[model samples]
Target: MKVQVLLRTEGELAVVVGEAEGETWPEMQTVLPALLRGVADRVEAHGEVPDAAP
Candidate 1:
């Protein structure tokens, strides 16, 4: 599987986008959280914290 991740930040807020091809929706869904967490971890390492949904 191939995954692509995009990150956007505005001040202290950050948004993440993840994309993958060659996978079923269920398969993609299963892998997304880990991908997103990895991206989030990298972003946070640079001192940007993503906004939490309320």
Candidate 2:
């Protein structure tokens, strides 16, 4: 199985996109948590940093 995830920041919000391929549920189960955690970390970091004054 193959899994890919992307996280993007837009203004004060964030977007998460994920994809899974192949028929390997077991592998996905093992990797999904880590992938989700990475996205969460990025979102948290983005939240902690204030936007530049406009």
Candidate 3:
């Protein structure tokens, strides 16, 4: 899988994420929680973070 991080703002941010080709959405779903938590923590602590896209 490939992970791309994006900085949205000083206090709020977004993560631009995508998996490698042939990866299933279900598979990605498995790790979403961890990814989101990590992003939230980083955003809170650092003021900028990245996460999965809608």
TM-score winner:
1
| TM-score of candidate 1 versus the correct structure, residues matched by position | 0.53
Ranking by TM-score: 1, 2, 3
Return whichever of 2 and 3 wins on TM-score: 2
Instruction: Please write out the lDDT profile of model 1 over residues 1-54, one tens digit for every residue.
Output: 666777866765445466666557778788788788877676677875669321
Which pairs clash (backbone N, Cα, C closer than 3 Å) in model 1? none
lDDT by residue for model 2 over 1-54, one digit each (tens)?
A: 677786655665445456667677886887787787776666566566455222
- 1 against 3, candidate with superior lDDT: 1
Superposed Cα deviation of residue 25, candidate 2 (Å): 1.5
Q: What does each candidate score in C-alpha RMSD?
A: 5.5, 7.9, 7.4
Q: Give me the displacement of residue 5 in model 2, in angstroms.
A: 0.8
TM-score of each candidate? 0.53, 0.52, 0.47
Q: Per-residue lDDT of 8-40 in model 3, one digit per residue for the tens?
A: 755766545322322767776677676666666
Q: Which ten residues in a row are the worst by lDDT in model 1?
A: 8-17
